[model samples]
Target chain A: MIEFIQALRDPDIAFLRYAMAAGLLAGIAFGIIGSFVVVKRISYLAGSIAHCVLGGIGAALYLQQVYGLTWADPILGALFAALSAALIIGVVSMYAREREDTVISALWVLGMAAGILLIAKTPGYTDPMSYLFGNILMISSADVWIILILDTVIIVISMLFYNRLQAVCFDEEFARLRGLNTRMLYLLLLGLTALTIVLLIRIVGIIMVVALLSLPAAIAGQFCGRLWQMMIAAAVISMLCIAAGLCLSYSLDLPGGATIVMVTGCIYLAGFSVKALRR
Target chain B: MMPQPVISFNNVCFAYDQTEILHNVSFNLFEHESVCIVGPNGGGKTTLIKLILGLHHPASGSIRVLGGMPHANSRRIGYMPQSTHFDPSFPISVLNIVLMGRLGRRPGSFYSRSDKAAALQALAQTGLVDLAARPFASLSGGQRQRVLIARALACEPELLLLDEPTAHVDPAMEQQVNDTLARLAHRLTVITVTHELGFVSRMVDRVLCVNRTVKLHPTSEITGEIIQEIYGSDLKMVRHDHQCSQQGHTHD
Candidate 1:
């Protein structure tokens, strides 16, 4: 514990500031996206995408182990796989019958299996378990910049298309009839959701991302009377969860992502209980 | 010469897969009249309303609202879905739901003070001003229906299409909704699809009894014989369960 705090005290890891900043930024994105995911009932989708990351990492690691391909960034490989699946599910939803849910669920498992298998095949290259859960402490400056940029872009796009998103979420048919071009909107939202899962991979871990995306919104639903309020409330709760988890991890020397998710779950349970009691 | 029908349906046909929902439907709805589509369950009454509101396209025929295609004039029509279809668990205030009527007024526009005032006024007009701040999910059946009516009115519509406006409210508020429709008919060209034959018979200027095909009757022509011909069952003392009725009204 002393070494960990001492490590933080080190000016050599001066970039801890950036890691926290990026984590907060990513938290904002997750919170906003999480708001709609709760309203539209897509937390399961978030979970599926997170688990699918294992497949992406696994493939990248396996290729590097067997063929001597660079494993420097296995997540990129995971990202490719995750994005590919996201797009496939997106297309299937339009053309197929009630099978998009099934496809997404299938990909969730497949993504995990593929990642674990590739990791097994690969020559040991830095335990990829961190990627599955996440390693916030080890986040690179480039990773921070990428997360900041993605969150900023998502925020701007959300603001720019705020009305359109609102229209789409509340009444899709009414939105389409109003000349909103709903098909393009659906793809865009799905793509953004995929990107959000990818961004959250480092801080919250793939397995725990669903909690980050769902807990705040579920709690916020009680207080928020509108979409924008709901988003803000989620963001606030998420930041608190992130901060509290980091503090607790610092004290307990535990896995940060799991700690954060556990904190969020507690908040969710407390809120759920209070709500139920009030009812 | 035609008095420029506000809504014109030229041989409109709609089907769900193989079974036809609306077959060779044609009609002209004028600016000054209120019309209702009355039919049995699964008889395409809601389908006709959807075609008018541009929520669904006809299978083979063309539909025009206010001299343009339905989609083109989406801004001109205000639609209130059936009360049975509204979601009780939806997280929104009566005021916010009402303001949604202005969503199509302009794309990417912020709600102005005038818009706020208009929503408030509509709520007041529908006797829902007291419930405006209440969460929609917490409202009683009658009040929720009133909020939706307020939502439809918030648009200041030149044309209004309601699907079963009174299908969930108590018999007391059902009359209130019917009265609100009666008032709206003076300004907007109102076309509602309903099963409330008792109230619709008096409030609507015309009625369209729909099944696979449709039969349009001027209000003056409707009689006991026509009801016997269409429903094949009786609405004489029947009412939809308010609890089950409010299940998915917003989904409409």
Candidate 2:
């Protein structure tokens, strides 16, 4: 613990501070968007979008290496991929011309396959593991700034649409009857979830993104009786998990993302058991 | 000659992909009238309600609501669904659920003071004002039904539509709901869709029997033959004192 604090202050290890800041800043969006994702029961949709981020990251890396496009940042690639996946999923699920689960599952697998193929074709020996399971310690100062901006955008937009989103999540038919363009609102929700997933990719990567996104909200759902309260509680729980996980990883020489997910999972299990026993 | 009907269906016909749900259905519901839409399951009772709410469009014919296109005046209509399909563990409060009735065409917004006031008033009308702060999932089956009704009322609509309001509710809760609707019937046009014949006879001025087609009869004119026609010969009718026999308007 003492070494971790010293590492936090060390100028040579500024990446530690950046990682910490990014995780905590990203936690706010994680909590808010995750609550909606969980309550709306669209975690499967979120999982697909998160996985598609890899296809973008791989494509961006390949573009930068092959075509010498310096501006094609992987994060930008992730944002593009996530948004595209969200729109396609939103439209397909809304129309439901085909079975929703079949389409989502197909997209989920296709995204991962596309990402792997793109990464394999890239010239340099890039480690997919680092992106597959995130390495938060690699986050740069620029990453922190991007996280901050995305975080602010998410919080503002969510707060602005709190009531409408609540209505959409609760009863879409009622919302439509009330003259709300429910389809548009549903698409907007997907768009926001895409952005949130992009932010989460850097913290826990694609595979474990759903865990971090859902666990805190699930834990909060056990105790809180309101969506806003659940969001606030989830955000706090997420930050605590990230902070503790980071310190534990630093001290114990463990992978940061996995450690954080483990901590969140443990807390959720504990909460679930307590609630069950009380009943 | 007459005040405009709150809802008018002109030779309306609706069909699912291959099956015809409602055929040549026509009706005129006036202002401040309580009408019950009754039929057996799959008899297009819900399809009729959906047509009025503009959730589904008819394959042919015209439907007018509040003197405009079906959905054009949707804001003036309040709707309570048969049952809300939601996650049982959802953390919304009763007040928030009711406040959703005030949702308008705005994209992203908060509930205003007037919206909250209107929601509270609707809750009071449903006799659930004290439970407004409680979690919606914590309410009983009857209370939940009333909360949904309150949500509909929260819109302060001129036309209120309820689908099976008494279904799944206990006798005591059904009584409370009946009383609430009885009071609401005096002010606005109430259209209820139900399978309960007793509810139809007691609460509505008229009954619209739907079974692939539409038939309107005054509550007193609902003979056993009419019931048989609507329900078909597959099911037997349980004649009660409230039932209409060969004798017209039997009081006992």
Candidate 3:
């Protein structure tokens, strides 16, 4: 215990500490948004959007090569691509309800295709592993600060608009019948989802964003009945997963995001078992 | 003490894609009347309700409610949908469903203490005060229907619209709900779409029958011949047989 305490004083340990903190904060934001995602019955849509982030990163690369933008400026590129994907999904769903899922699938595949082709053509690609999953260690102080600020904004907005969101999720047609501007609310929800996924690209790889968003809330669902409690429980569960996964990665020399997702998968299995036993 | 028309449709027509359903139909729903819109399936009964509630716009006509366009002034209309496809696994309580009724007054606002009190009152009116703490998924069919009615009532609007409220419910429970509607007829204009010809017979002040065209009949004017004219030749025989068994009406 004395040696362990002393080991924490190392500069490497301090850097790892901040990385873990970033992961934990990212997890909380993911969990909070996830409750709504699951309740809205858009789990597949969440997966689609997360996977769709590949286009953003790919666009970032293109911008860096052609526009002479720094690699660090990829955040803006990611946001633009993410928002464009969101807009496409929205427009298709609005005009053609029957073809909504098909459009989403096409967008998802097109994004990945665009990403692979763009990256394949780019020069001097060195950060492949980090893009595939995540490298928490690569996160700087500025990245952590950006995530913290984004998380605060997400939490505050979600809390304030909780009722409108509930109305929209429960029944959009009924919400409209009662004179609520459901179309505007739908747009707002889509924008928020796109923004959150873009902000969380660093801590949880864009590929794994949905898993981090959905798993904790799904686990928390077993323990609570109300929306607010479910959100709180999901946050707590996410914190546990991030902390345990970070520590496990430190001890076992594994990928942090993959380890965290694995821990979440195990917890989900345990929740399933308990549910079965209760039945 | 019959109230004035709170909902009026003038030359109203509607369609889906290129196919028209309603064509220049006109009607007025006066307040303090329990009206049931009865028609065979696919006669655009549900579509009419949606148009009136502004869920869908009329293809060529005007629908006005409470002195304003129906879609623009939907805040004053309370609606209860058919409990046909509700997800039983949704994580909400009966009270929460009922509390949704207050959204009109405090649009996009959080639930205040006053909202809670009003929700409780609505649940109490629908005889679902005891189920306030119960999970919505666990309720029986009739109980769930009542809870939905409670949700609509929580809005405390001047017009209440219920679609197939008594469907899937037992006859005894159906009668109980009919009694509830009768009690509510005095306070607001109530419109229901129902298949329960026998059950709703006593409570409805007026009936609107729709085939390709809509025909209005006062409750006293209802007869087996009129039903046959609207439904077709086959239903006439069924009504003849059923009406013969009735103690109140003479068979033709």
Candidate 4:
């Protein structure tokens, strides 16, 4: 702990500052979006979208290696893949309600398989481990700026459409009757979830992204009486968990992403037990 | 001049997956008319309601609400789906749920003071004003149903649609809901789908017995024979007075 605190003050380890900043921003975004994801029962869809990011990362890596495409950043590729998957899933769920689960499961596995194939075909000795299990130490200043911009966009959009979003999430049929264009709202929500998943990938990676996205919100749901309160509580819980996880991982020489997810999961279980005991 | 009907369905036909639900269903509900749509399960009753709410479009013919298409006038039409569809464990307050009714009315992101006042008034109408701060999940089944009703009332709609409002409610609470509907019927055109014929209040101006087709009857003209014909069963009509007497006997 002493070493870690000293390292934070050391100018040589400036990446720690960026990592902490990224964690805070990602935490807030995940908390807000995750509340809706849990309440709307779309965690399964979120999981599918997270895995789909792997396909984009692999594709971008392969393209850059083989075609020498300098502009093809893996993060940009992941964003594109996440957004497309979100749109496809959103449209399918809306129009083909009966086959939604089957289609989502198919896409979920296909996305991962496609990612593995693309990564295998890449010429260079590319290590996909870092993408799968995130390394917060790998986050760059550019990545931090991307996260900040995405966070700002998400916060503004959520603030602007909070009531409409709540109405749609609570009862879509009623929202439709209110002339709220519920379909558009649902698409917008999925889009936001996609963006949030991208932000979380930096902190927890694709494999554990859904946990960070959902667990905090689920814990907050246990105590909060309102959606906004749940969002705020979840955000605070996420930040605390991330900070603790970061310190623990650094002290013990553990993997940062997995450690954070483990901390979040433990806290969620504790919260659930407390709620059950109260009941 | 006679006021335009609040809702009109002219030869509207709807089908699901090649199975016809509503067949040439034609009807008109005028201003301040309260109608009860009662039919057997899977008998196009919900289909009619959905059509009116613009959730489903007609395959043929026209359906209009408030002098326009159902979609065009959706803002003026308040809807309350069955309470069973709501997740009881969802984290929301009674007031927030009620305020959702004003989503269409509010021009801004936040609710205006008048919007809050209207929501509070709607809660008051349903006798839930005091419980505004209570978590919706903690409310009793009947209270939750009332909260949904309060949400519908928050729209300040000229036409109100309710589906199976008293389905899972106990008799006393059912009576309370019916009373609230009765009071609202004086101001808005109310359409409800219910199975409990005994719970139908005197405020119902008409009864539309829907099967594959719709048979409209003035409330005063409804008879047990007509109900039997509509249901295609020997179901008996239990009057509200008889239910009250039965409750009184149980108490005694």
Candidate 5:
């Protein structure tokens, strides 16, 4: 514990500052969006979207290697894939309500397959493990800036549409009757979720992203009565988990993303047990 | 001669996946008229209401609400869907649920002070003002139904539509709900879809029995025979005297 605190003040360890900042920002964004995702019961949709990010990463790698495109940033490729997947899933679910789960499952597998194929076809050795399971220590200054901008956009949009979001999440059919354009709002929410998944990919990796997105909100939901309260509590809880996970990972030499998810999972189980005891 | 009906369905036909649900259905609902739509399950009762609310469009012919397209005048129509569809575990306050009705009136992005006042007024009308701050999940089934009704009332709509307001509710709570609707019927046009023939009151001036076809009858014309024919089964009708007796016995 003393060594961890000493490392925090060490000037030589600049990456720790970046990792901590990324964790905090990701926690805030995840908390706000995850509350809606959990309440709306679209965690499956979120999982599909997280896995779909790999397709973007693979495509960017392929494009950069074959065509020598310097601007083929994997993150941009990821953003494009995630957004497209979100739209496709949203439209399919809306129009084909009964077959939604089947379609989502198909898309989930297809996304991972496409990513693997594209990466294999690329004429270069790529370390797939880092992308599959996140390596927060690898987050660059440029990555931090993109994350900051995305977080700001998420915060602004969520604040502006707070009431509309609440209404839709509570009752979509009723929201439509009020002339709120529910379909459009639902698509916008899915889009935001996709972007949030992209932001979280660097911290938790694609496989574990959904855990980071959902666990804090689930814990918060158990204790909070209102949507906004759940969001705030989730944010605080997420930050604590991320900070703890980071410190533990550094001291124990464990993988950061998995460690964070484990911490979150433990906290969630603890919360459930406490509620059970009260009952 | 008569004020234009708040809702008019002219030769409307609707189908789902090639299976016709409502065929050539025509109806006219005037202002301040309370009507009940009763039918067996899958008898197009819900289909008719969806058309009126603009959630579903007629396959043939035209439907109008408030002298305009159904979608255009949607703000003037309040709707209460079946309570079974609601997720009780969702994190929301009763007041917040009611406040959703004011979304139509929001000119700017933010809700106005008047919107909050209107929500509270609606809650008070439903006798849920004291529980406004309560979590909606903690409410009983009847209370949840009333909260939904309050949500619709908050819209201050001229026409109100409720889909099975009394379904899954206890007999006493059903009476309370009917009384609330009866009171609202004095000023607003109330259209409800219900299977509980016993809950019908004098306030419901008309009854539309639907089964892929519609038969309009004055409330006085509704009888056990008609209900049996419409539902294709022997169904008993609770007489007004029986309801009075039940109420008195319960109180005693």
Candidate 6:
């Protein structure tokens, strides 16, 4: 832990600072949207969106490595894929005649499958594990800036439309009766969740993104009495988890994302157990 | 000229896919009238309310609310649904839930001082002012029902629509809800969809019995026999330990 703290200040290892900054910045978005996802019980939808991001990452890698497209950053591709998946799922859940669960399941698997196949075909020595499970230490200064910008946008919009989103999530039918355009509000929520999921993909990777997104907020729900309180608590919890996980992983030489997720899971389990025992 | 009906449903018919839920249903509810909509489980009681709220469009006829199209005048109506679908573990205060009643004001805008005042007033009306800071999930079933009622009242609506307000409440809480609705009925046009036969006599001036079609009867015209005859043994009446028609209304 001491070594990890020293590493953050070491000029030679600026990546450590970038990784910490990125994780903390992205945690704000995770906390805000994850509370909605937990309260609205849409973690399943978020999981599908998170898995779909790998497809975009793989496609970007393929295009950049094989076709030599200079602008094909994996992050941009991830944003595209997350928003597209959110729209498709949103439209299908709301308007499509097809079964909702079947579509969600299809997107969940097909995205992962396409990503693996595309990664396999991308020329020389590309490690899929690094993307499948994130390596926060690999994040650059540019990634930190992107995370900060996305975080600001999410926080602003979420606070701006807090009451409407709360109304829509709590009782959609009643919200519609109040003439709140609930359908559009619902789509907007899913869109915000998509953007947050994209930021989450950087710190936790696609496989464990939903856990990091939902766990802190779910834990916060146990302590806070209101939605905004839960958001604030969850964000603080998320940043603490990231900081602790980074220190532990650095000291113990373990995988960063897995360590972070395990820390979150342990806290949730501990809280659950304590509550059960008290009862 | 006669004053406009608060809600006018003109030969309205609603179908889900090919199944006809409500066929050629017609009714005119006037201003300040209290009506109870009662029927069997699948008798389109809720579908009628949906049409009036403009959540669903009729397959055939037009519906008017507050002298305008249903959707256009939706802000003038307050609704409390049978059940609010949400996670019980959700973090929301009773006051915050009630404030949702004032949702028609622009999306990006914050709740005004009047909105908060209105919510607190509604809470007071439902006898829930003391519980305003309480978590909505922490409330008992009856308290939650009243909170929903307060939410509906907070809209300051011209017409209030309540779907099954007393379904799961205890008798004591049921009486409280009855009192609240009775008090509100004096000022606004109130429509409640309930299956409780006793609620018909105690709360409203008229009963709107809906099957595939709708029939309006004055409260004096409703009896245990008429209900049994209309519902065909499918409707279960909550008799409160008395034999059917023990309240002195004859079967015939």
**Candidate 5, clashing residue pairs?**
none
When summed lDDT is taken over every stretch of 10 residues in candidate 4 chain B, the lowest stretch is B243-252
Global lDDT of each model? 0.77, 0.89, 0.77, 0.87, 0.88, 0.87
Clashes of 2: 0
- TM-score of each model, in listed order: 0.86, 0.95, 0.90, 0.93, 0.95, 0.95
lDDT of 2 by residue, B1-252 (tens): 989988899999899999999998888989988899999899998999888988899999999999999878887889998764667689999999999998993444888888899999999999999999999878888999999999999999999999999897998899899889989998989999988887777768888999999999888787677887888877676645353422346332
- Docking class for model 2 is medium
The reply for model 3, stretches above 4 Å from the true place, is A1-10, B1-4, B106-108, B232-251
Native contact fraction per model: 0.28, 0.94, 0.57, 0.79, 0.77, 0.85
Model 4 alpha-carbon drift over 4 Å, by segment: B1-3, B232-252
Mark the regions of model 5 whose C-alpha exceeds 4 Å error after superposition.
B236-252
Estimate, for each residue in A1-279, the C-alpha lDDT of model 5 and write its tens digit: 777778878888877778888888888889999999999999999999888889999999999999999799899999999999999999999999597899999999899889999999999798777888999778877887888899999999998898998888888988988888888999999999999999878888999999988999999999789999999999899999999998999899999999999999999999899999998
Candidate RMSDs in Å, in order, are: 5.8, 2.3, 3.3, 3.6, 3.3, 2.5
TM-score of 3: 0.90
lDDT of 4: 0.87
Give every collision pair in model 3.
none
Score chain A of model 1 by TM-score against the reference chain A: 0.89
Measured against the true two-chain complex, the DockQ scores of the candidates, in the order shown, are 0.34, 0.77, 0.60, 0.72, 0.73, 0.76
- By DockQ, who's the top model here? 2
Q: Please write out the lDDT profile of model 5 over residues B1-252, one tens digit for every residue.
A: 879988898999999989999999888988888888998999999989888888899899899899999988888888999998987889899999999999967556678889999999999888889999999999987888999999999998989999999897887787778778878988999999998776553457788999999988777666667778898776655466333211122211
Q: Put down candidate 1 lDDT per residue, A1-279, tens digits, no spaces.
A: 465557567778754555566667788887788887787676777678778878877777777777778854765875777677667766777777666788878888888887777787777755767876777777888888888888888898888877677667766665665456777877677777778888878877778788888888888987777778888888888888887777677678888889888999998999889888998
